[model samples]
Target chain A: MKVVEIRPPYLIFLGSESRATYAKTGAGLAQWRPELCSGQLRLAADTVDLGLPDLTLEQAAEAGVGSLVIGTAAVGGGIPEDWYPVLREALSRGIDVVAGAHKRLAEVPGLSESAAAGGAQLVDVRVPPAELPVGTGKKRRGKRLLMVGTDCAVGKKYSALCLERDMRAAGMKADFRASGQTGIMIAGCGIPMDAVVSDFLSGAAEILSPDNDDDHWDVIEGQGGLFHPGYSSVSTGLLIGSQPDAFVVCHEAGRERISGWDDFPLPSIEDVIARTVELGVLVNPAIHCVGVCVNTSSLAEDERKSYLAQLEKRLVLPCVDPLIDGAEAIVRGLR
Target chain B: MKVVEIRPPYLIFLGSESRATYAKTGAGLAQWRPELCSGQLRLAADTVDLGLPDLTLEQAAEAGVGSLVIGTAAVGGGIPEDWYPVLREALSRGIDVVAGAHKRLAEVPGLSESAAAGGAQLVDVRVPPAELPVGTGKKRRGKRLLMVGTDCAVGKKYSALCLERDMRAAGMKADFRASGQTGIMIAGCGIPMDAVVSDFLSGAAEILSPDNDDDHWDVIEGQGGLFHPGYSSVSTGLLIGSQPDAFVVCHEAGRERISGWDDFPLPSIEDVIARTVELGVLVNPAIHCVGVCVNTSSLAEDERKSYLAQLEKRLVLPCVDPLIDGAEAIVRGLR
Candidate 1:
């Protein structure tokens, strides 16, 4: 709801393609104008030559722009040649650049240079991964916290943040951690206690690589995929490194059991507890809880309650509204 | 946490595999320890051969015992044979048969026959699903409701129940409903509402099945699973259904993101609003609010609050404790 305005005196960066993103330039613009940005129109239309590094560099320097906003392009495979050096050179000059969503052009190796060169920065215009709890002496308190979703736009980060707030409100010491791919991005937030499935996802972990001597609690780590290779292995490794007193699992509720292929009616609570024990850890068993975040557009309260209650009774943990009490409950579980 | 003891004259009405269940006494005994049972002594230390029949006609004729309990080996699966004769006989003879967690099963195909034959009535030991709102013919005061989850047992039921209770307490006509598996298990909780994943898991209809058929006042449906195969199909279907008045998603909080090769961060609220409009639904672009539930074992209030605040700023959803204000917020959103 807060809007910040930028005028034409600064640099403007736009993306070349629109893949899996909002076409901000089209009709959706006026209707869905960014509420965060207000009082604009200083810079009308100034297109820098992304195809030419020298031209791009000259334009940036000539403009003496303190802030640069760039649009994103399609993300896949590799990055565009001109875009790479242009971005790299810009970063080296200590400029701030905000660009549109473009993966193929930015993420490719040797294409988008890692780190802002010359102190330049890039702000991904699209949504970014959430920050994690990264600070010193931050004790993790909770039996286990779980966020449920297999797809994007399922409200996972929202759920986690809400829980973090509630846990603190309830007077608990809790830190937000990641067990999946977001771990890499989350690290920017703080040093993660452990990454549950990072190894399986092929994510590059600079802080805690699973291969270099399994003791990796000194930094952040993440989970890979739902059923990725070595996911359980990495999870076990993280568990050992951080030795979390509690656990939180992210999940999607009311969805059918997975494919009926692997462990449908998955295991009883006892089974899961047993697995935890097998890993040389003993689950409090009764301390586990599930927070069910629902798509309000699609379900009823009663329906939501029934499914969660079944889990509560079966799992021997209290089922709660994740947005409301999930974080608090996780902290409590740690207690 | 609460345990009770019940003693019976111990007449056992058998279902289809009652005899087999009784014969495989060792397995049953192994599953439930003597210490956990109500009674001090085992009825038959050496496995009794009580010779039970399957599918008998003429209720009450088969039952000649008092304080009878129904026993079955396949507790959760296919209907057993001996149950019919026992139920019919029990009912005919005016004998009440006590069964554990079989009420839902009694409504199933084969089990219905067994109950008729043994004349045995169902006494459900399991907790019942919550009740639905009574039809008042008065238009609801708040927004139409929908509850969804990432997967099964992510606290959907508990959250729904809590919401229903809160809404009713706050003076709303909101009712709980079942759309997918819960519908078959519980009745009169609410009108059946199924979101995308529920329908996909059930394969009964598309995600937005109910809305496609009818567009009326506020409705709530429970969702299950997170991105299961059925979830995508059903969600797409439901999106094509009557566009949701407002979308609310329930998920687990305090856990890391579960990544996929294809999964990415949730779309920005602006993108979501655009999509909603494209689907012909009017919506407030900002996420109404988020309810975060957390475990409060050992977390500090400041820690929780800071994290929640950070999330609120990032997701643009005013976050609250689901247990406290989730239902109330939903009702307010309706306004």
Candidate 2:
């Protein structure tokens, strides 16, 4: 029922360090509800080198893009030096700059002053929670929905955000509570849960959703998968903290193994649902899995259909590819 | 076989915060090998009122205590103000300082210069790993003995350290690998695994116990229980990173639940053994629990006798209260 207003179109800027590992972060902006922003992705290097189609910075400038989004994973180095000229150029043009990288562009020496002088917002998406409390075992009130996935980078945030938007569009009072860098960037407010202290990971979730009546819903974004070797703790913390009343098991069609982990085979969708429900019940025993949110974008049309059909057959719960079918089914299933 | 020559007798300093939650940490040094330190606990405050027996700083000074040990957990506040005067007094005396608190005593205002002037060593127990690598699932060299536990604070480090000592006493090349803050303090090296990034938690463990030949054994300390809601991630990361050839299941005699979680009931000893073995196999399938290290300190003599007898009878593996029987049976069992 509410749409952001007075915000300018975002011109996504992907520098040399933006591809391969971080390509999804850059592509997510234009791909997530394209009409929400001006359709332009500006590249620092030759446009032809990009795996995906994108425009050069000059082309974005020619189109008079209103905002700059640093849409790349920093891969630990945080804000590559090659990115400064384009970032300063964007700030000097009076364009608001938003970034999901661990490094804050605003901290690039004179960039904050440049942003201040140009009257632009300098946003760092992974800013940790200002104040987070240790999780109390006390039960909280809310119709909370969580999106868990079979692997990392499987669009749990996308599904959660989609559900939030659809619920809002249907005249329901709902909010999207982000749990990671990408989700934080999109929501404009959320803690990068992984970067938080080990004890505060779940506490971040509890603070984000808090408590609300059944009539009000909280669409909570999920983190890494439970089977992920490197980042499973973040997932476990989110699962313990959110205590969702119901959850969506998110997965990509035809994915055989956990991404980046060749040893971890993807669990059956049913197993994923069972594990999620089991974790939820630790806090709220009445909790359950309401639906399946499959990302079938990578599969061929026949492959997608067959894969979804197999998943639907296996799971008694309603299963839908949120990207293609929208999350209306999931929103309805939460009831 | 190797007693460190440079380190001198530690005069254990327990601030007012010592007795309540971090009583274990204060007591750890006193108890690790009581004879390793002088029988002196310096009180920061009043004449008596300490939850334990102790000596005054002047008395310790008269005895020529060589170093001061901050024998208390900071509980995240680091060094408390009330304890600073006593700390300054210790530093002024040219006493080498050792601590396991998250806060580094060396960095406390004027303390580093005081230490420098006094020609004393300022040691921070949990001073992170020097460099860490992502777990490559590569085969590593060494006979790793990991001490897993049924719950947190149930003596994983105690057993690991005990095994290390017992192995060395038996004329073997053994090294203790610390995982948590307290363990790091005891061993004088190793990462504070909980403070590590989620992706790097396991990686920290891998780096701490690098490749070594069969002549050497690594007795790695464990952290959090897998069933603990607040800290399971830390436990899981340690388990994966250690990839032990064999493990020892540690537990208190009367603990029936997870430490901070009232809802989480403790699994039976059999279940704990099975789960530890299962997780160990995830890293190296041939891995298993070689013995049990029970902390029967809370039990009466008759109860301890019957409980351990029942455990040893039910499970074929050797089960010993390491403090009582000295972990020699467990060390032999690792073979």
Per-candidate total of colliding backbone pairs: 189, 0
- On lDDT, the candidate that comes out on top is 2
Task: Give the range of the ten consecutive residues with the poorest summed lDDT in model 2 chain A.
Answer: A1-10
Error of 2 at A259 (Å): 2.9
User: Candidate 1 regions off by >4 Å?
Assistant: A1-92, A95-117, A120-158, A179-230, A257-274, A280-298, A324-326, A329-335, B1-335
For candidate 2, lDDT tens digit of each residue in B1-335? 11112255667666665344565555676666465466445454542232443656666667777777766665674787777777776677777777766566766777787777767777665555434555554558877888777888898888888898899998888999877766655554577777665656667667767889877889998887766666766776777777788888898988987767777788677876776775556568788778999999998999988888899899988899988889888777654
Which candidate wins on TM-score? 2
Model 2 steric clash pairs: none
lDDT of 1 by residue, B1-335 (tens): 01111233234433323244443422232222222212111233343434332222232234333334444435463345545544544444545444444245456444445456545445433322222211111112234444444433344554555555566676665544444333212222222223111112222211212332132333445443223211222232223232334554554445332223122232333343343333212121222323423222233677666765775676565444455445565545444
Error of 2 at A292 (Å): 3.1
Task: List the candidate 2 regions with Cα displacement exceeding 4 Å.
Answer: A1-69, A72-97, A105-107, A112-122, A168-173, A277-280, B1-69, B72-97, B112-122, B169-173, B313-317
Question: What lDDT does the true structure give each of the candidates?
Answer: 0.36, 0.71
C-alpha-based local distance difference test score of model 1: 0.36
